[model samples]
Target: MSEVEVVVAHRERATLRVGDVFLKIDADPGRTDIEVEAMTLAPVPTPEVLWHRPPVLALAALPGTALGRLGEPSTASPAAWAAAGAAVRTLHDAPLPPWPGQSLDEVAARVDAECEWLVSNGVLPTDLVTRNRQIAEAALRPWTPVFTHGDLQITHIFVDGDEVTGVLDWSEAGRGDAHFDLATLTLGHEERLGDLLAGYRADVDLDVIRGWWSLRSLVVVRWLVTHGFDPFAPGCEVDVLKSRL
Candidate 1:
């Protein structure tokens, strides 16, 4: 058997590399989206219910940022934005049955709980939740719900030239409010968000999506400030998040 070594650890999962295959184990019980590299284009068996979401096996990995190869680094380009947009569109369109465990509210509550811990620990300024709740509630209004990537951000997309090859992470994939997904993207990269929206279905309200961005950014700032920038850590994401706030 090939040995594995931990490459990265997060709140919910740990990445282990064995030979050419990367094993992503969810910290939570009964969650599986493990990906194994396939060499040829062949039809694989339908994934068991244990497989969690259907993994994207063929998308080529891209290079740019250390976190994920998301579009053009720092500077925004049309081709890059379009690539990111197309990637997300593909990810969102992938055929997968509902996740077996964890409800959407549970996930939101998990985020809220993490924020609450930060507040209780005094890492986040007091009144952080109060202010954020108001913002999120206001932003969440005026949008219908759809299946979302849940943690969709520019950094999750892999881009090359004018084409998007893949979306890197899928641990947080679920059915939820699509606006929240758009919001998270817009909040982090406001300048390039318009380009992403352009690739999405035209019926979506950009204003509402922007509002979600504000709320999502607020939560992210609180999390990074309190937790010391673990997600996409060691990079300038913490600095960027702080700049937005």
Candidate 2:
């Protein structure tokens, strides 16, 4: 048997890899419930839920390597990106889940609060925060709610030979803005967006997606720092913010 290995250990949760099985432990059982349901409902491939015992949920490992890692160059082919795009498109078009996601007003308020904190602490230049906030306003308007992966990042998708093998981390899945998924996927790799959008074949508001990118980067910086992670790492969240300036 392979030795158990820790994949992630954050304040809120932890994931351990043991042989071909993954064990996710969280403080809240409701989150695990959502993950299990989302996996079941998603049209795209997802890691199989092996079992669940209270806070610990067991999952079978998926095939293939991650499509790409955050804060690093993507070695995945353009076709893989396209496949991921199509998978996300399929998910967005699927029927809505029972739960509701954050409303646009709630998101806008969070963005505004985060921006104020950033400027007050001198964590970032005032001009940079202001400009991005202006751009972010485009995303705060009403949008038709669709199923979203909430945190659909490059690191969460697995691919092999231009095919999406699986998607992981579905605790945040719910009805929300579709551009949020697009923005989350293309956060730091904006140049590759065309390849993904080409595969999606659905028209989306580019400006709104860009706004989500800025709003997300700004709000997450504080959380990352508090968790002992660096947002300023090369090609990370801070870098994405700087790119918009």
Candidate 3:
């Protein structure tokens, strides 16, 4: 038997790899359905869906490594980063998934709640929380809904050289803000934003993208900590948040 490599094991979900197959075990089957459907609809490369039975969905591994991590530098070339950007544009241009993601109001409310949580728990300085909340407000404006990868972290993208091999974690695919994908991908890797944006080639509101950087960093700390991941680790989420100050 092959050793089961734990990809991620959180309160609501877990994923594991055994041999060449990755099994996603989710708490919600509906999300899994959405993932399978999104991959089918997306024009870009995606892993072959092997099978699904109840809680577990099997997927074949794709070529290459992740573009980068949140806190670490990406060794992928600028061309590769641009390729990622192009791939994102393709996905955004594809048909919308059946579901809908958070609206601007929903996002604002969540940020507000998380900010209060952080402040009340003394997790972050009140001024820091307050400042980021204001920054986050910029992203809370109306956006033309597109098919967005609700979570477009670099880790979800696999690349070989300058080309994208495949993208993973389609559970969050839905109609949402385009800048959200850009912001999510470039988080903590601000230096590469210019390269990515160059490949993206469409005019975007920079202020909102920056707003999401602050907004996303503020909201995710609690979840990461609760899941036994250290958001405060060097070159990690907390470090990214501190970089803004």
Higher-ranked by lDDT: 1 or 3: 3
Model 3 scores worst on lDDT over the 10 consecutive residues at 236-245
Runs of candidate 2 with Cα error greater than 4 angstroms are none
lDDT per residue (tens digit) for residues 109-172 in model 3: 8888899999999998888788777788889889999999888998999999999999999998
RMSD of each: 6.5, 1.0, 1.0
| Residue-by-residue lDDT tens digits, candidate 1, 22-138 | 555565543343232111111221111222333212222344432232223445467667556555554445444344323545545755665676568765455655555444554
| Displacement of the residue 178 alpha carbon in candidate 3, Å | 0.4
lDDT of 1: 0.49
**TM-score list, all predictions:** 0.63, 0.97, 0.97
- Rank by lDDT (best first): 2, 3, 1
The superposed Cα distance between candidate 2 and the true structure at residue 90, in angstroms, equals 0.7
CA lDDT scores, all candidates in order: 0.49, 0.92, 0.90
Model 1 misses residue 112 by how many Å? Answer: 5.4
RMSD of 2: 1.0
Clashing pairs in 3: 71-235
Q: Could you tell me which residue pairs clash in candidate 1?
A: 183-213
